[model samples]
Target: MQGNKSEHTIQKEIQLALSKHKCSVFRTNVGKVKTIDHRWFDTGLPQGFPDLMGYRWVDNQIFFIEVKSQTGKSRPDQLIFHEFLQSHNVIHGIARNVKDALMIVDGGLCGFGYD
Candidate 1:
């Protein structure tokens, strides 16, 4: 089930699960935006930012998730960014499926604190 899912599908499933868990999450589109005149402009976020960002109300904790397919590998920039987030004591992870994402947000698998 995980290996065949697309990143988009995984993201949607994660979003839905998070919503049900009472977390406020949104997808982050980090790329060039096309204008009506055929112009392209940056979205202003640094490259390799996570795919989803949100806050959990229970603890008022913020989280960032980089959704990927089961076989998807993060780019070098994404790894660097994740390291940066870790250095800052942030909650962030690369989630390949809804379960991974839930674990990340719940602080269960990425060494963020939840036991």
Candidate 2:
């Protein structure tokens, strides 16, 4: 199923599913933009920020998802960011399909217990 869809499509599907489940989701666009003066500025997020972010009310948890196509690979900065999230006990993952994304948001994987 993942082999055919673009990342954007998968992301939309995931967002819809999450919304149906009463979770708040958002898309993150990361890149640099050139100003009229020909100066480049980042989109303000740290490099490698996840493609989506949201909060799951049931668990009172926040999650992040990096959407990718079947043949897509994360860049080094993204890998670093994922590692950082893990170390900080943040909920995050790479999702190639809606199922993967839902799993991450549902805390089926990449979830840490809080006291």
TM-score on alpha carbons, each prediction: 0.89, 0.87
Q: What is the model-wide C-alpha lDDT for candidate 2?
A: 0.82
lDDT of 1 by residue, 50-88 (tens): 899999989878999988887787888887778788878
- Local distance difference test, per candidate? 0.82, 0.82
- Residue 62 in model 2: shift from native, Å? 0.7
Clash count (model 1, backbone only): 0
Residue 30 of model 1 has an lDDT of 92
Candidate 1's C-alpha lDDT? Answer: 0.82
Stretches > 4 Å off in candidate 1: 108-115
Model 2 agreement with the true structure over 5-114: per-residue lDDT tens digits: 99899999999998898799999989999999999988999999988999888877888888888888888888888878888788888888777877777764562221
Best by TM-score: 1
Worst 10 residues of 1 by lDDT: 106-115
Q: Give the per-residue Cα lDDT of candidate 2 at 7.
A: 88
Candidate 2 error regions (>4 Å)? 111-115
